[model samples]
Target: MKRRFNSIAPSTLGLALAAALPCLASSTAANAAPAAQNETSAPPADSRRYSARGRGDRRDKWIHRWAPVRNMWEFGIYGGVWFPSKHLELFGPTMSGSGSGNQRLNTVAPDVGLRAAYFPLRFLGVEIEGGVMPTQTRSSDVSATAWALRAHVIGQLGLWSVTPFILAGTGLVGMQSASPPRGIGNDQDVAIHFGAGVKVFINRWVMLRLDVRDVVSNRAGVGEGLTSSPEILLGLSFTLRPKKKKARPRDDDRDGDRIVDKDDFCIDVYGPPPRGCPQVCIDDNDGDGLDNTEDTCIDDPETRNGFEDGDGCPDEVPPELSEIAGIMEGIQFDTDKDNIKSTSKPNIDNAAAVMKKYPSIRVRVVGHTDSQGAYKHNIDLSQRRAASVKRAMVEQGVEDSRIETAGVGPDQPIDTNETADGRAKNRRIEFQILEGAASKTVKKRGKKPPKDELPVEPTPEPKPDPTPEPAADAAKPVDPVAP
Candidate 1:
């Protein structure tokens, strides 16, 4: 039984695949182009030159476009053969005689039916049907005739134009057969059916269909049999009402910004900045005080001052500041102090040199601490650390006031400080542009500056202290006993 079932499995799967081909083809075609007639409209001559400018724009529109066949109802008809696989038994009193010999009679049978269906949802529908067949067997010793009335509820799945269906229901089987004497019997039974088929839309009002159905039934005293074997059917289906026209695709890009404006907060502009929408026409995607349209160092804001042409990008590497800062881990510092460790100096210097090169660009050096310390202590510590960094830059020839300092105590840890590693990771310093000095320089130059002169160092301050002692230290007594 298992082998027989397996043998038919491939054919059954093939039929299912064939039935689904139409739906797959339709979906592919729908996605390949716009549902609208002008899916591939050509741009006007003037717009062609600015095509690159609007790439972000077109993509925004495509995302919001609607599909053409979203909500439409379809109706159709189907027909098939019914091959009976078992016999109907007729019982009567004493076939020959109780003492002489006992006998029983049975007859072979066949059946046929009609099919109708309606779709209430995409890829699904319900079907109602009825049919008839004969159950007479040809023999001199005995003869029988059977008639059945069946009503089944069918379920259908649409794959493009093809639809596959299954059905199950209860019906009455009336049997009549001849032996030593004529006899009749009526029994209640059940029928189960499954089928696969395809529908071809001829127009808005009609469709052509082809299908094959297999049916199995249970008859009292005759066991179970294939009441309806496979049958090839061809039929026509008439639509009861005209379907509504599909809506045109929506334009997803809401903002004129180059980015595809999808669920973007900056609905009017495109933003390349992570978690932000572009608000201005300027192309500064990272919001690092450097506009990508003008900054050569768009990825590294620190290098913005080292480049000329107000494009906040770097042109040359400073010998003293060759080390790269780890933005992900942040700048490490000494315990309870704003002073960056000697190991981190190279990275800080690199950043400072970049700032010095762009004299006009100023940076905000922010200090953060782990939550282990008191809030006030952490705040003071963070501020002191920020001040220390600024002082170091000033000592390295950066303008005294060009660097802004701030302390955010244990408030913004990138990781939870409940663990040792996380606390260590949270103690850090970061550089942010307070004002775009590169943009200012470009504006002052009146025109784009030479790329070679991009590394314009800030005018050096004379003997300025890079680090300032806390005001509390200055007021403290040299010795506690002296006070």
Candidate 2:
């Protein structure tokens, strides 16, 4: 049984190796899984790929999505078998005779290999390696040994804790066997090897690797020419350099919007719930004056009322109420005349219509004049003219109580009084729609207009001559004639 086992057929070993590979791969996957790291070490965005961080810059990250290792050095020890494609024919002394002979060698033999690699960059490395194995030209005959040494360039790609690499190298190979009636000397030659394999990191410090190499040598002490031998090795490697430390995104974004954190007013949150950090959904739109954080009504458009309209909302003013300034060009008057002009009718009609439409409106109809007349006379004229205009509007069905009249004389001219055009422009009328209807600035509550500004009362009608007590009333006229 020992003799049978030692001479195991080549076909049997091939079947055994093929059956064992999948078992090794499955075992490696099961044991090589990495533990989750702290949140500080996790990438900022994707869970798989390295975090790209800022915009546009995509270089300088791990080559593998799941492999976290960067630049480092690795040292590994490997043990495997070298199988010859064709039987190696060795020229050596025959065990049965005292003469030299040749015999084909085909057998499974064990080999030991060692490797040292330097990874200067992420995906590239250089390795120096050597291996030795004892050999036999004939299965039960005299045994010999072969040695190989190489310097290889390694190119690697890693994915999800597994790194696969390919190697190409040129090296030296030697085979020697001595034990016979005619001892065989050493056969040495230059050799070239190329193959590929994989490495699985069980952790940062330890990894498992498997390599396959095909070595072509011109000088195998064989009677036949060159020999092509393939070798397979599995190794466990240790890293000499420490694992790299990953960085987490900074806490500078307090609002979770990715804006400068210090610039945010409503820090630590995004409004309307389900907020913060992982997603930034807020939008400025630039429609309102303020940013979304400061806005109370975030979606409402600004009123543009020239107020603090930045709250992303329009001012709440009634549709019927609007400033009388600049609309319909304000009321205008002829020089020294307080009577409503035909051109002014359209404006008056609009004002009356506004009042009729909304009963809450109270208006001040003010009269102004040029500086041509005496100050006091102008004051009185402006007053009467304003009163007369009020009466005309009262006739047009506006409520007298809703209207207030004022005469500023030349005190408030809208234009220069030195020219005719200025004088004409100066003598004008204005309808100030009181703010009690909407905003607070138009008029103050419960405050009366100045006493001096109230319109003068109209002259009283004379009573019918005291109903004559005829005779007695006639005596007074007669007495003057008689006396």
Candidate 3:
């Protein structure tokens, strides 16, 4: 059995190595040559600067550092076969029959024992064990079973994944015999043991292990001899909790962008230059004049007058105005017509309500006609139609000044006019606000005549008198007369 086991061990090791080679090769390829070359070539400038700032290995210098794992505790169970090397003796006079020339010698016996160990330190431990095993003897043909308890101090070396350990201890052993049948007896004894083992961490919580130990013990009685035993075991271990890492502190200068709160200068509104503010921080994110930090509607540029504090974005965009051309219901229009059919009234009414709500908002009303008619006539007709819509809005209480009317004669169209639907869409009206009206109020003051209409230019205002000249002129006159 031993020869077979020894022969199989090499095969198993070979298989394991074979299985690991690809991963090992990949890791070596990833980290070996290129990394070494990079390190040699770059010679990190920062590392040199840091070393100059300190003496010796700055890598080990005491800087604020984080440890991912520190203090932890583990628990586990172990099971193994025990073998005893010590000899046990039967304590009786030599077996003899008087004058019969028959004599017998006392016997020496050996037994096997089982054990358990607990490790308080990862590398060292103490073990307590108890077991009973049958013993064999030479001489009187006496047979017995020995029961023993021992305590051992243990030490381990090598990688945590595969550690080897040595142990030593002393304990009391009790024995009972048959065939001269001596009853139970006790003796103080010492034991020495050594073992090698491996541990596999299944996870943070558990580990599995296998180990073997050889034990030796001594005893004295009618006869003395040496005993040797070996044990094999499998075990499982557990940890109470894993260690937690400390967080690293950040180094920041002028951290005013809300990135590092402690180092921030402008905690509320990020400023530019020395404050580390964003480039666009001052411009309204919503284009609403209110900076992004304060604007609730950062995406829209319109303002809400009632709130007065929000960025100019309206609390809500009017649903009617949100559409592409502010037309809903798929309403189609005839060329150059201001007269909306009954079907289109609902969409128009919705837009009208928005205009009424935002009374200060001014809209440009543009009319377009298809290319079927003469361009000039189409332009005239479209202009008339746009004026008609303006009149309608004015009648509907929308301020005339708030609506600018214009006509585009077949210039802008949604699609090719070769198609009927495209031509119909081409003949349409659209509303857009004058660019700056949202920021500045729109007032409908009467139109003043053009500068050309009111005389080519106003008579230049009379130049102001350059100076009070009388005193100078009188002095000059007197001087001239004297000359």
Candidate 4:
């Protein structure tokens, strides 16, 4: 059998080995895969339905101005056919053939490759590639196998699911092993390669690739002097990328209610609704829009007439409660809170009693706050405080329809905000009695108060003799008699 094998022509032997390589590589690859991933197993995500969010839209100027981080890595296994061109056969003379020059190495052999690449930029990548192929000479039956380890640089275009790229690289290739077991051949040569490929990302972590390359080597001492060859491969790749963390801006919540403004309906004030706002005060026990921190009558309902109001309470207000704060004196609220205090309940009742006594009075509740924290938060707190006060009166028989509410926060501080006591004084609520057209309906209707109850009007300073008619200008006014 040995003699017969040695007697076979080199051409015949090389052809046989060239054809056997594909089967061997395929079998090896198949056995290397996990048993569960069989031919009939499910495939990966479909490329037809694959897309990244906002992948192809117009991007902002700042995005294009700077480089984006590239964290994706690619690893793949490829198998294909390589055919050396006619000119490549000039590397060495044919062992056996009748011709003026040796024919080119024409054997079509299978090449197997392992590739790993990193993209530092979105459109560019650097790759490390290793491959092995069964090689044959065209002039005779001489045969060998070649292996290579190379470094490549590639450029890609079109940022989408399907991307096309061009590559160029250089490396060392060995044919014939130093030890018989090391490889199929012992000869080594330096070579360069350039190619193009298309990558199809099925998802963020997997892709399919089709690659073609042209390799050049100088092997004049061997079968060919100068060689250039082509390899066409198909491969499946596994992509690696780090998980992205979401970013949130500090000012996302304009009103520090812990709810982001994008979803908050009451962007300026706080309320209760999913993605709307948080409950205002968190102390409105009576549902009368009054918080216990400031409500004088924390036990009653400041319920609205139509419930279609956002001013802390319902529309019904007692007429006699002309000034909301007047009914409850010495009303002091804790800093940053809006709940009505337990100690102020009687004062709240007194205010309610006074309103019931004077049914015609209209009350206005104004909220105040010290300059201890954010101005905006202070404003909201004051408004809530005032609303709670009104709720207290409304619960104690006061009409919800007749009361008016406002919050000035620290804007109208009556005392110095720098001192604790001053701040405390500044934070006190004020109730002002209103007469005449203070009511919205009354002002719109142009009605005057009854004669029996005279409206209090502030004394006005008389004009100072109209500046004595501006003596010089008055002297020129005699033209009125000319007509």
Candidate 5:
């Protein structure tokens, strides 16, 4: 059968090219724009130049900026028109009863393709590309699909964010069709391809690519020549970057210990020479004078109240003693006399109640005098006052032996003696534990008595006991005398 073919269809080719024009134009315009427009708003100073002040070259500036693209793998998909040669050979019948003659494959075929490339260096790479074009023979109603695959070596140059490249490679081309023309069923050929493309990098990972390639293949059957097919393609590509290898540190000292991390036992801790680690020497964690090794209560410092100073524990005192001290705060005496005020009888009774509450702890009635009087007279008066307090406690059901008396006579002032408040504090009575289950002391400081109250006559002073008085008070601060 003789066959005829009109010119190739323009609609398919025009529509595909139209779709790609806007993108191509925009990319080209962007790439062609002046370098200044694409530069950073404030351009980085050229490192090669010295300052106007004639200092030194600014070589280290912008050293930390990251590269947009380097060695990477690219994969892309493209679609465009494949324009085949009009003289493309197809072995088939050209006329009625003819066994072999010239016939043509379809001129215009819509082509789709996939491309993968790897760039080991900045300017060189290798790519493997595969494409499919669906068309038909010009003389018959038979449909056919043509496939071409090629591997190419690419050379490229990076200009700003765009890369323009050229490639050349060779691979296989094949055709599959139903009831193909005579002498031509399924045919395969060795094809050579040369192409040039440009990649517009949108970001570090995504890019737009436009390529045009001339695919040359040997004519099948009786023809001894080759035909060329041109492909115009536009595609989107994604680049994958290889993970960076970490370099070993030459010498690293994180803790500023003067020791390199490799040989240092504790790289993070600043310490001494040998191990480069800290040695915790906690001789006294509680700051109680005694070493932690000998301290029974390492967390709590010792009271050191002259009770049991050897044992490193805070001496536990009865709360009743504090209550008795509070009650004695109301224990006012007649001015400069051992006589107890009659109005202070209630406070004396309350103090006796606290002493009776915990009868196990022994009590001492120690007296203090202000610096107003002669030292010897103050001592004599304070001693008589302490005796009176003891007598009162004894009358309130406290055992006479549990209460002892002493007079410090302004020697140990808890506050400043220069002030009136300090003198009032000095002239106070204290309750100390002479022999008790818990070795602790309590002091009850009295405010000045009201002059309107009557004074009880002083009783005879008790005989001095041979027992020694405590050297000092406990670790706690003395309570101020209440008004």
Candidate 6:
């Protein structure tokens, strides 16, 4: 009988192997085709294949929904220790000397198995396993082997490098005794198992797997009851399917601009800049009629009030300031002294009045002296003269804070100092309008302008014509005479 059983087992094993081999080959080919298809660049025809089905196709939607781990396979072999329950019943008759109730399976045995799993979705998989355990009846000392074939539904949570899973399954468990003094040579029972395990991925294709499970079975015939066998297994698993490659996107420029559409600010309009648009299409941030690239002051609009209009800066010269400059003359000072002459009072008063009319205007009073004196002394005299003019303006209702004073000796002379008339012209007062306009020096004209050029104002009463005679020391004083 043992010989017959051995022969039948080999035949059954051969048949199972033959059936499984073809399936394995077919599955491998099918899985490889997708990988090969993904390996090369997809042709234009192939790219349109999915588009023909429309974007909302259910099959395509379902496949892409679980992109992470879908269509993956894992195959592994494991070895572990199986602890049989004390309630495991024996099939053979017990010896006359031994109590029948005392018969049980061995305490522990080595168990090994092969498992194959398929992941249809990211979080779920189905696995099939087959295992064998060598054991013996403890009381009887009869050698036996146990076999388990299981099918499990696995639920797993996949993280970066680790996956933890729980599984439950039902299958057939068979036990074969070696030369047992029993009625039946073998026993079979239906078994159910549940377990939890973790897989630690060592890399893209290899992983370490561990499991702990409790398998429960119901024995048949007399002395029958439920038996529990617990197992702990550790092994390695390898991915059976190659990863599919992702398609590369095409770089296109819809507007014929050099910039790709993905980076183009204006995808529909063609022109300069990475914006893919015309200069006119861009905003004038300063409202200065110039785009940001052309405007030096992007935030400040060009005044466009005639002066330096093309510079895209604010430089509007107030007309009132120009008028004030025209009248700022004849503010003469005593030779080498900072005292303003009484004769120049009208001009100073006129300037003060104009400044008062335009309260927003500020001016810088600059003094000049002929180069007839020591350079240092001339500079000092010029500064004092400028201050004197500022003081007079302040006394006449103009805010002292609105006026600034500066002195430049004969270095900036507008006329030669060789003659008295030229010297007189050089030692004159000038005004520079400092606010809301470009700075410009205003000198008194040697001759009076036409009535049309003179700004309308309260005319001063005419005075008797009188010119002071030169001081006796002024004819021949220092080698470089002071003006």
CA-only RMSD, every prediction: 31.6, 38.5, 32.9, 35.2, 42.2, 40.2
For model 4, residues 1-483, the per-residue Cα lDDT tens digits are 988777787879899998777557545534543342242133334311212213342221222222212767889999899876555423433333353344344468788989998887879889998888876654344566667799989898746567888999999866642222222225567889999998877654678889999889874543656677788999988977654432233333434444665555444444334533333323555555544554433455433322222323224444444344343466766646778888888878878788676666655677777765434445567767888888888999889977777666677667786698898777777775543222333211112334567778999987676554566656655666687
Whole-structure CA lDDT of model 4: 0.61
Better of 4 and 6 by lDDT: 6
TM-score of each: 0.29, 0.37, 0.33, 0.39, 0.39, 0.39
Please give, for residues 8-69, the per-residue lDDT of candidate 2 as tens digits: 87778989987777556545433432221132334357422211222332222223223524
Which residues of candidate 1, in runs, are more than 4 Å off?
1-80, 89-113, 140-159, 163-186, 219-233, 245-483
Q: For candidate 3, what is the TM-score?
A: 0.33
What TM-score, to 2 decimals, does candidate 5 have? 0.39
Please identify model 2 stretches exceeding 4 Å from their true place. 1-68, 84-99, 103-106, 179-183, 219-225, 241-249, 252-483
lDDT of 3 by residue, 1-483 (tens): 999999999999999998777557545544553444344444335433322212443222212111112233445555555454334332333334432121122232333344455655566767676656565434444565666677777666523334456666666555555433232233345555556666565544556667676656554344665565566767776644332222221112222232442333332333333433333325355444456555445566544322222334454344544552333334445533546556765656666677777665666666677765334445555666666667666777777777776666576666767789888777777775432223233322222333356766557888889886676556644355565
Candidate 3 ranges with C-alpha deviation above 4 Å: 1-74, 89-154, 157-182, 221-227, 239-241, 246-483
Candidate lDDT values, in order: 0.51, 0.60, 0.51, 0.61, 0.66, 0.68
User: What TM-score, to 2 decimals, does candidate 1 have?
Assistant: 0.29
Compared with the true structure, the alpha-carbon lDDT of candidate 6 equals 0.68
What is the C-alpha lDDT profile of model 1 across 1-483, one tens digit per residue? Answer: 999999999999999998777557545544443332243233334433222323443322222221112234444444444444433222333443334222333222344455555555545555555544444433234444444455555455543333445555555544455444333333334555556666665443566767566555543243544344344566777644333223221222333333332333333333433422422334455455445545555565433322232454444433422332224134667665556778767766777777766566655667778875334445567777778877877888888887766667677778877799898778877665434333443322122334675787889878978998689658855776765
Clashing pairs in 6: 372-481
Better of 2 and 3 by TM-score: 2
Q: List the lowest-lDDT window of 10 residues for candidate 6.
A: 438-447
Candidate 5, residue 382: how far the Cα is off, in Å: 77
- Give the local distance difference test score of model 2: 0.60
lDDT of 5: 0.66
Worst window of 10 by summed lDDT in candidate 5: 58-67
**Best candidate per lDDT, number?**
6
